[model samples]
Target chain A: MQPRLVRLTVWAAVLGLAACKPKEAPAPPRPDPADAAQRAAAAFVHCVEGGNAACIRTGLPHGAFDAFVLLGWLATGSPVAILDALSRELVAHSDPRTVQGRFVREVERLSGPLRGAECSPVGAQELAPMVTQLAQATKARLEAIGMASADMMRVVEGLAAEAAEGLEGAFLVRMSCKREPYQLYLAMVPEGPRYSAIGLMPYLPRFLGGDEAQIDAAQALRSKSLGISGAAAPVPDGTVDRYLPIPMEEF
Target chain B: MFASFASFLLAVSVGLSSGAPDPQARATAAGYEQLRGFATVLVTHLNRALGTEHLPPFVGAPVTPGLIVTADPSRVQLFDRFAVPLSAGRVSPPEPSPECASKCPKILFDTFRRWWFELGVESRTHAVEVPDVVLIGAHRDLPAQTLTQIAYAASESRPIQPPRLMLLTHGGPAGVRGIPFYLVRPGGLTLPPNSAALGLTVTIEPGRFVVTAAARSFGRTLSATSVPELVAILKDVHRHHPNKAAIVYRFSGDVSVGNFVATYAAVREEFPVAVLGDDEPITIP
Candidate 1:
């Protein structure tokens, strides 16, 4: 009886040990680098689309103006040359009482709040009114800077209205805008991981061509898109079509 | 007894099969996809009437997405993948020259000031000298004759010293056109010892400068507010090495050319200087 009892206890102990043994946990999947980038890009597009002033301003990367200057440098020879030219232009109308000074002050007044505002999302209704106010103020300021042409202000107003309309439905894609003299390649690629939608500002003109030549170039760039969108069939190349009216399943 | 042991093995297999996926990781991935979906709903309508001519496509964060970049004009393409690295917008390293073979050491040439440059080596023990033949990593946009012209100019101006200066650059020669000539002056610049290089970034922020060194021997960054102050700091940082240290200058895109030229002049007035062109590598010790 004692031997049989000992055998029962040993078998019970083996069963208990087997039940309690922990399984090997699988290694966590490494997050895709593209996913994070795409997310950052999406956040930026949403900020712009929604007119979240704070998001837009905060999203403006540190060297935002630097790209502007460098793009100017491409045409003006050097950053110093552009600065000097600007200085000369400013000094020509140095009087704060002059139209130039008022224009500068007005621009400063309009832009200061946007620049210093906290990083937060604003309501949809809030942005459209603010943008219209900005557009009107901008038109007024242009007149101060001697751009008071009826045609010019009309064009500006027309453009502003069109812009508001364009924001109604816009999808964003990541295009690597590289200029000549490769270092400027950083023109759109930020220094660190954070994505800034404004880097695309320089390329927008090219993307939205004004002339036949500009249109051709824009078409060429669009042809290079990775056509993942099902709306348009993929070019013989593997890249997806440029435009997608509907959301993709990959998302 | 054998049947009991077999039952224990079956129990263990059941435990392995029951392991559940971590909830947190799945949630994070799902959140990323949702945000991506929200941003990607509608394509920016092609409306040229919107006066968006000045605006290019929206700038995107750096992403390669399995695309290959070509060598000449160095544009990114979808097909024809290769093993070249993509960093800070630079494509490939200078194709290793036959002359360099294993011994080739790269140096950063201020292609802006073709005459000025800093020397690098394959290793610590490598001997130092100026090579008569320097290779310019030209963009395909650059004419082929540009290489011959640069080589001829370099050969013509070989310094009267041993360790012949072979001036091969890791940066493309075309991009230097935008750099202000005065910002990187050619005069009074010295050839630093082959030991280590120091990095200095001139920024758009008024009076702010960031000094950096990548070596464990040196700490990462030193900030300075003025040219005189920057010079003093550079002097103090490299005091031990004295003239042995080289300065690699990186300019913020928005940095006023005047400020950059001032800081660059002050530093180069004392140490050898090379402006970083096209994502060139810098060394520090």
Candidate 2:
């Protein structure tokens, strides 16, 4: 009876301890969608600014990257019908993963011009800060000239008016990199819960000659440099002028 | 001789330490030449940075004469264009200088008055032309018309269409504001076609149809208010235009890339013969 009574007391103690245990902390609240989107978008810019290839890839989803590349390629004067047909053929043989890899490589190549550049991801609403930067630049430049106070004010006022007029109705998310003449404006679009950036025009410089000729030549040269062959479409000159098309829905 | 040498050394040392202004710079600050001097200096710096022998001269397009708008958030002013006051503050005029010695301020005022007058006249006249290179002040809000006005003031001087119209915003990287380095113009364009080539102007607006016309040619006037309606008209023209006609785009700097890309894409779709007109080769940033 003593042994049995002792066992019963121990079981009661165990039950009391179990009942007294605190409830587990509630699951962390789901991240807000807007904040998530902003963070996701900014991460891409951060990676690019950091010049991290791996980080860039991680930020870029397959679909978003493809859409960007296709848009830029088609913009280079490729006839829609021709590209539509060529895109199908290119997609047939190319792997989406491999296409993304090449794109990251292309970004790595083009980022040379923008190396050490101060790039900022500007939202549609957050342009005031940048505008202020521009104002400072203007003031310093004008001040350096040693103009009269009134004259300087006049110039600054006019510029301020112009800036006001020009930016009134624009709604865009841009990654503006401070290059020589002002800044390089690259557009970004929201994809699902995140955002993706477009950066390709810097590859097609003007010195290569006429529009069609230059585009073809640059693409062919780019392809050769990348050792890309089977997938890229070859122009009449026996050089590949097109990149492998990764099929993405209209973005 | 030793005393004189010592004094000369002292002056040289003082000048070097103080970074004495050059004669040209000193002269540039005073008189009517100041306006022209500013232009020369700005252009020289732009050319040096651009690696080009000549970029079109900068024509200042201040909104008001004699008054300068600075980006001072403290004081706000209500312009005719805005209902709310702008954060850009005004510079108070200095003590009246009736007997002005430099004459630079007078010249600046006169030049600004003329530009403002011309701009008003141009707007009233509904001139469709844009300038080759316009330098709007270094403010952040690029309202559609301001940066584009850079070329209009210049257009008053040179009526001819330049090979390229480069629309840029002021304020560049630190210490380079005087030089207009921010290029705001759209890119990926072919060289300007011959003057004789037929041209049509297409204005870009987001998610809306645009009506455009061939203002360059009389009797070739075509109209459609929306982009789709205009695209239909251009399709007919492209199908039949004997000479490969070129399409010139006229838009405020505020036009989005999506709108532009869509418009360009639509034009490219119909005009497989390719009659797009622009001054420079595709020199995008």
Candidate 3:
């Protein structure tokens, strides 16, 4: 079933945290993995909430931020992360108005168990102006290219109820892009006072497009037919189809 | 250059070679005339065996350059390793009729041995270069294995060769893993059959060096005899960084050279084929 994209000011506690900005409070230099995961998720959610373009440079884990750029290409083929590619022509000549405001309203809301997104290296300082130009001047271009719009961006979408999950690790935060053929899985590993979001692509560049329906149907059938209620249903086609696990007959 | 095949019909069906060396093979080293004929047959047969339908210098492995290959078979396809056919010309066979059927093993072994001599290989009387490695598939008997190694050593530049005597296992018969040799099963003479032995692959895991048998077409689990020498070689080569041909021979129930040919072709059909050394070949479940 196509999930309804409901806009809400407040959501279930389990829905996860958003921009809980505390003014002038710098996160600790080295946060624990648990703390880092919360901090990373909040940062990503906060940035997406306001189309916080700065997240690309300093907000998310440097590795995750870099991955966003790569994933953007696979997700939309729109060059949403093209500004961060450091290309001379696109960097200097591309407009920057659409992305600049994303830097604002990015106050860190560090409530809940999620913590410690402060340890990882923020992306290049030089990339700020370039990102600003892309976010603002090229807002439509960004959307056309599958860049996450400010409104559609959220840390956890649909109570984790409406959306299909790809991975769940002790420190992983994964969400599928409902509109496009992509999903991102980020991880929080031991590194700083906070968890490092290095190697975030568990389901690296997972494409959720044409194959999504087949995969979902197969999953649903397994969950329903097998009477597996509340349990995680394994993808039916492990060896064959990404969405469908091997046929029952093959068993 | 068209590859001339030294056709040796396996005199025994899946049975070992008859205990007789080919007179033609013996006479091959006798003079320059015989040398030319041997060279042609060796090159032509190897080129096809090695699947070098096109590569110019389609010199099959172990046999170095400086040797010539000819094919008197009019239907002979002159090609290189790349599968590209080369220029074809009518050439004469060295003799009136193809040499009579002789011991197939001795022919192949003798052919390789003659090439070494023609290549001016260094040889010692009492001590032939030691064969630190034993090719299980190449020889069914022990003595011929040693003798084959005698000529084979010139092909390889080994320092202190094993004594020309009984073949000793790295471990015991059960433990002995001879050098990695591919047991090319009876089929795969045509194309990459559902089962064609390609080569051996070694993957180093956490603490162990894992060796796997590779084939173009993989389905069934590959089986290999476990010998200590193979294991020793795997342990030895694991010390190092990791890592086909249609010769159709019609045969009946007769245990003639066809059986040996088909069998030898099955294993040696593809040289450099890796036999599981450190461990027995296991079927991937």
Candidate 4:
């Protein structure tokens, strides 16, 4: 009886400890969205570095706000990372709290197409908060759909330096910039009900010989060097041109 | 020199500390191929259920499908017409419309959805907080009559105020009897404006004996009153038009076929109507 009583006391003590410990149901695990956002931010920066901003803006026009957000995301990775990025982009004359406080405002007010068109795009003053939000939002959005962040990361990771014809409404427009030897091909994407800018018009720096025929020929040749067909618009001169049907081959 | 070193160190540290891998280094031939598959999947996911089905290869800028008004949701259909002419990647030479035909609920929605997803479109205002990429489809000056008509439409849509909406014309086929194409925006917005908005692009399909036109009426959430007014306008247009069909094409950003069929049938009792949910492609109905 004494040994059995001792065993029962030990079991009760263990049960009491189990009750004291907080037991949480395992939520379906989610990859930190912060990671995915950071990657997207990194990819945008890498793409920007590889291509010209003017050229990219020609496609995205109003500077890639998401990319800038990612840029901030990368800069202010955390409180620790913010020490460097925020310190540099921070308005020296302004209070640090004020600079930090500015993030509460929308990213659009800072550097969206509206401001870009109004000739008042985001500047150094708003940079700190913008990037911080970019990072946070990216993380939050991806986190919401446990799989969305991963999938988008894969998409961004897979992005090539060609026209962004991934979505259904993307197509190529050959713009005759009036007497320019090399016409331009605008990789136009759908902007709401209407279509958006001359986003993906790639320009080749090399002087083309007289024999060079097409508008995006140089870039086409370069893309060929990379072993790829020219993206959506490669200057169709005649009345009729070829259009790859929607859901274009991914690459 | 000390400042330079510190700057260099900061730059290097930032580069190193940033959590992303060297994407440039991985951007290779094989990388593109791997990316291609992933891109398809990612696009599919972004498009949601709309991505699952295969799209028939037709060669035209997006156009509206023939409309058939029916009470039955099952009877609703949408389709496409391809190999049409494209100018600046837009359907060209359309205003109040010059021509007609049938096929594809897509072209307009293709334009609408394309705009909906790609552009950082906010509500009616530029105030939508998004990465805005405003569409400035190469502008075509509106004929005075078309502008007058637009003013009338704006007044009808917003009865309390002077019409402040604007219009831009886009893609149509080459030849006689081309359709009238126009997209409505805020009065001051221009092609390549600072930002983009999700508005209604009304395309009066080139032919008759079908619906007269299509408009991007709503996005995501459909309303009972959202498209019926436009439907009435199309009927009014048909009354003036020589060729008349019984249907008009309408599309929204994120609505399903079943739900739209159910909703419209309940709300719109006047016409024998058919609807296209998000499940299928623009079929040749």
Candidate 5:
């Protein structure tokens, strides 16, 4: 009887050990911040490549408007086929608070309709607080995404700031020169778009008679009158010619 | 006890081997490996070409350098062509130039205007006639009409814009074209503008349905008409492939024109331009 009882106990032990074989551990939980950042970046790249800016707002995190602005600059190359894809992805995941703040900040920076004189001052005043909130949200999202240390992100942001400033100066100059027949020539330079103060035909008497100093002064007044003080002066003809000669024959 | 131990061992072996992922998964993994190998080869070739040291061979075969003159003098006309004015504040004005700037007699502002209009018409006709392939070239001083003609050709018929590959034979102001142009240095030698004259060797194989451009003489400046003329000649060759095509162009005195003739003979046998996206064989409907 004692031997039989021992055998039974051994069988029970074996059964228990077989039952205890561990099941595969559940897939590790995704890190929320990393996942969100990756998704946002992927969605943004996709939309910009597809050439659909309108679709990018949806996939953005609750406060990441700056990322959307960055997308616009990066989407300039090639056919920009990915923009449409990104827009669809962003819009499907709409949480306005996630992206609105950054959007407004970027608009202000890009001189997007929000900052122009053509926009009513009353409307601007009303939207100021909302814009501020958007900026803060964007900053928070950037921090969350760990974009603070990214060199590429910083360069993109810097370029955006420069473009915004340039656009503002250009707008001012255009307003001041509105009465002149001089037409604006906006050249899309590699870094950003540049506006020539106004171009007049070389054969025209006024243009041919004017000395270099006179031409420079007119451009300066246009800049000052538009309240664009710190803008870079018009590039010298020699330099401009080397870099982008007026394809005069192929206008 | 022995029977139970054997059963347990058998079950573990079965799970380790037969219970592994399906054959389809294994095949997919193999397919991915092959894809990776092909990608590696492509990337390696591209890197070699772009590297700072030795220049890689041209992507396609070489062909005889050629030229075309629109013998039809009646086709020439003139109209307002777009031009960037000299004054800084001026808008681009409509200047008149020759319609056939490439083939027409050189004239000042008036004759040039008429030449531009003719060129625009020719460019449009080329696009319509050869919907599959159109090659264009512009001299350092491309007339405004030539640029507009290229733009017009690029805009016609394709839902999406077709790719434009460009090779700069001269350094000058950027000219407008329907397609994006790349600047290539010939003989792997990079030289500054005004230091060299250049010519492009193009071949079109209509039977094979392919077009190829080879960078021929370096350090030479070709006229704006040279590239368009070369393209027209290639199109003509495509029309008479598996037979013979004639090339006609005057060369600048600076370079050995004979070298171009020999190089084209050697290169023409290899490069042929085919329909876009038809690099591989397919059965025509």
Candidate 6:
């Protein structure tokens, strides 16, 4: 009986040893760098195309403004191809009387000389006179309205600031008037980053109806939406349709 | 045999007790609770507007209540079909006009803004505000004397050498408009313009100097600096301006690289500076 008990104890010991031994963990599948990169790129493209704000927030590198701009373009349907085509077309046939013309003239002056001489060369002597005339005309128009010189100066300074940045390359002149609404399109350029800003676009309601009150209201809304001063007020629920209103007013 | 059964029961109890709440589940629950509260408020408002009977208090939080309205067209259609008839007597269904089409949207937007403001205030009360830094970059080379004057005026500790300079310039002969140039110095030095190249340089003192130039013009006369040396210079700058909140500079229009540099600067506890155009002084945090 003692011998039988010893054999049972030995069998128990062997079982315990077997249980205690570490099992080999399945080797982790090696990550494919190419696949990972492809996934990342796909996610980025999807976020840009889908215009899903949550997906954009998740896919973008944190605090990246480029991602924000790209998302904004996607949301507005102002992709790179559209923006570039618009810019080139505007540049080609822009008449000086229109807002696009004024911007094109300004860009031409600032950029020194475009490689192709599609238009007559603006001489150094003519440049200052033209700028002075434009400035004077702008001042007169502002005076005709209630806007103070300070406000006009602020607008001019803001536009100049934007031009100094590389934004001129990416954005096309949409429309701008001294007292009217200003709009710029982010042209779809094949190279580099692109974004469009419809500055004072929401306020076009005022220009449409000639209602100063509506314009003021729209301006306030634009400022809050753009988060110009600080953090933009969060988009209110059920107000998405307000951004793209049917144009009722004629130029 | 009874004791062995009791021991097994005890072991199962212990195993069950050891399980912890899943963090993801907890977060989802919290999110759902917030969504439910928002939905309740929204539904309550709609009910009041429609003069419908109030809904009973929900037993538990609702998940994706909007989905219910979307998935069930009949529910939304019922509201839409009834809205005109219900309001027809009290509020005359005004003739559709182009003006109304434009103005109606604004009224809706105003309501949304009000709701958003209330939500934001509520969130803010619960949210923890964290300190953050903003970094600005500029291609223009700043004068050492100007920096010294500002440093003296501010009464901040001055470093022995100038901070490493980062220059943004056009990339090459191809004339790529926006390319960033990074220059580093182990010991700080003032930047001086490269007379022969399309760059600016400043000499802080003997053996201390800083230079910025365009990439197309970055050969022969222009001296190159290492990345480690630039990091060391930044570290020295951090040492001197220990108390300042942010460091702002002008970016060369390269947001990605610029943000990275800004983050690096912020990590050192210096506030990133907003780079305004020429003549605008770098706003020290």
Count: clashes, candidate 3 = 71
Regions of model 3 farther than 4 Å from truth:
A1-36, A39-46, A49-52, A59-172, A176-183, A187-199, A204-251, B1-285
Q: Could you give candidate 1's per-residue lDDT for residues A186-247 as a string of tens digits?
A: 11223254434333221221212212222222122222121111232233332111211111
Model 2: per-residue Cα lDDT at residue A178: 58
- Tens-digit per-residue lDDT, A49-86, candidate 6: 34333322221111111222222221221111211122
TM-score of each: 0.20, 0.23, 0.16, 0.21, 0.21, 0.17
The number of the candidate with the highest TM-score is 2
lDDT of 6 by residue, B141-186 (tens): 2222222211111111111111112212222332212111122111
Compared with the true structure, what per-residue lDDT tens digits does model 4 show for residues B1-285?
Answer: 323333443454344335533447434422222221222222222233121121111122222111101111111111010122333322333332211112222323233222222111112111221211111111122122222222222222221122112111122232111121222222211222211212212322122112322222222222124455445654444354323222322333323222223323332333222221111222111
Of the true interface contacts, the fraction found in model 5 is 0.00
RMSD of candidate 1 to the true fold? 32.0
| TM-score ranking, best first | 2, 5, 4, 1, 6, 3
Q: How far in Å is the alpha carbon of A4 misplaced in model 2? A: 25
Looking at model 6 chain A, which ten-residue stretch has the lowest summed lDDT?
A: A242-251
Please give the distance, in angstroms, between residue B61's alpha carbon in candidate 4 and its true position after superposition.
23
> What C-alpha lDDT, on a 0 to 100 scale, does residue B44 get in candidate 3?
37
lDDT of 4 by residue, A1-251 (tens): 69999999999999999999999989987643333333333333233334333322233322222223223232212211222223233221023233223221222122221121211111111122323334444444343323233533422222211112222334333323222222332333344534443222222111111112333322322322112222433423321112111111110
When superposed on Cα atoms, how far off is each prediction in RMSD?
32.0, 29.7, 30.7, 25.2, 27.7, 36.0
**TM-score for chain B of all predictions:** 0.31, 0.30, 0.19, 0.18, 0.17, 0.21
A50 Cα displacement, candidate 4 (Å): 26
lDDT string, candidate 3, A1-251, tens digits: 22443333235332544335445677767544455565675456444445444443334323223323322322222121122121221221112221222222212221111122222221111122223222232333333323333422221121121111211223545534332112334444334344433323313211321122222322222222112123333435422121112221111
Q: What DockQ does every candidate get?
A: 0.01, 0.01, 0.00, 0.02, 0.02, 0.01
| Candidate 4, chain B, TM-score (2 decimals) | 0.18
Give lDDT tens digits, candidate 5, residues A130-221. 23333344344333323322532333343333334323322111111222212211111111222121100111112112122222222322
What C-alpha RMSD does candidate 4 show over the true interface residues after superposing them?
20.2
Q: Model 5: per-residue lDDT, tens digit, B145-174?
A: 332233222222121222233211211122
Considering the two chains of model 2, state its CAPRI-style docking category. incorrect
